[model samples]
Target: MARVSQAHLDARRRQILDGARRCFTRNGFHATSMQDVFKETGLSSGAVYRYFRGKNELIRAVAEEAFDRMRLAFESAGREAPLRPLDEVIDGVLTRALEEQARRAGTDRPGAFAELILQVWSETLRDESLAATLHALYDRMRVMWVVVVRTYQDAGHLRADVPADHVVRVLMALIQGFIVQRAVFKDVGGELSSGLRALLSPEADPHYRG
Candidate 1:
């Protein structure tokens, strides 16, 4: 009998996710079929169905996987000793995210998670559950940033006149807007850190003590 241990089970789950990600990247969420994933994974119909009840379940898992990656990316950036000030740190983090996202670009079949994330963002508007899930992820990310911003406020480093919470909100909004804008229009091009600061505050430079 084939031994099904925890490692094996996890491997199967990752296999399905990897396969779905590739197929989703190639065909998009709306067009991809479960049969496509099965073909990609080399899993039997029954075997694939045993792990995922349906496509929705598979997509949700894929989304969770994507979110996990983004969360780690941001959190790790926050922990790194920044070479610049608070605002610069925020800018730099986004700079990295944009760089990574841009690297993820290329209509030439990037990966399933790329289009998957975009589709989820678009579909969240029509699907209440998906919207709620996306909102929760956003909230968590914002909260993490709030802590980072608060550090500057406490140090009397950030602008005293402006609410730290507002700065946090601005940072998050800039990240989201830049990602969406870049995805939709490939025109805005430059170093993301510099671009983000300029986009967030056209008149102000992040290097200046505020």
Candidate 2:
């Protein structure tokens, strides 16, 4: 018997994960089964199970991979020397997310990634471990936002009086709302960057007296 190289093992694991993502995206979490994954990947039950104990573990792994990418996007944006404008940074991150989704789904549909996210969010309600994983990932992303908020405050771009955490919460809410809208409606007309600019800019809204 020949031993498998680490690269071979890694590729096999990725193949299983990619197949699982396709299954989950196509039929959703509850609808997809280990058998579906096996059929999709054309791998034996033993081969798939060797990498993942069960469907729940596979689901968790898939969700973690997606969220970790998001976390890394924010982490990279936060580290820029002269950080890009908030709206541009957000737009870039969203673009990257959609691109990744398109690559995974083998289509350029705008909501493919968003729909997968909705499924994960629904699954979290039933899976405590999944919920914890997502919560931790979100917390790390929120910290990145906090760092952004403080950076802007120090640079006099955002109001110094506003709590950083509060701003971070609103930012997260805006992104979440965008995802939900995109997933459900499939056409979220109007530019998110423009909306962010308007909301963040004191002079962009004339009717306000803040």
- Report residue 140 deviation for candidate 2 (angstroms): 0.9
Sequence-dependent TM-score of model 2:
0.92
For model 1, how does the per-residue alpha-carbon lDDT over 74-147 read when each residue is reduced to its tens digit? 77776643334654665555556545543443234222233456787887777787777778887888888777
Question: How does candidate 2 score on lDDT?
Answer: 0.84
Runs with alpha carbons beyond 4 Å of true place in candidate 1: 81-83, 86-114, 199-210
Candidate 2 residue-wise lDDT, 1-210, digit = tens: 999999999999999999998888788888999999999999999999999999999999999998898788777877762367777777678867866865786567758788889889999999999999999999989977798888877776666677999998998899888889888998874578888987877556465344
Model 2 Cα shift for residue 175 (angstroms): 0.1
Error of 2 at 89 (Å): 1.0
* Clash count (model 1, backbone only): 1
The CA lDDT of each predicted structure is: 0.67, 0.84
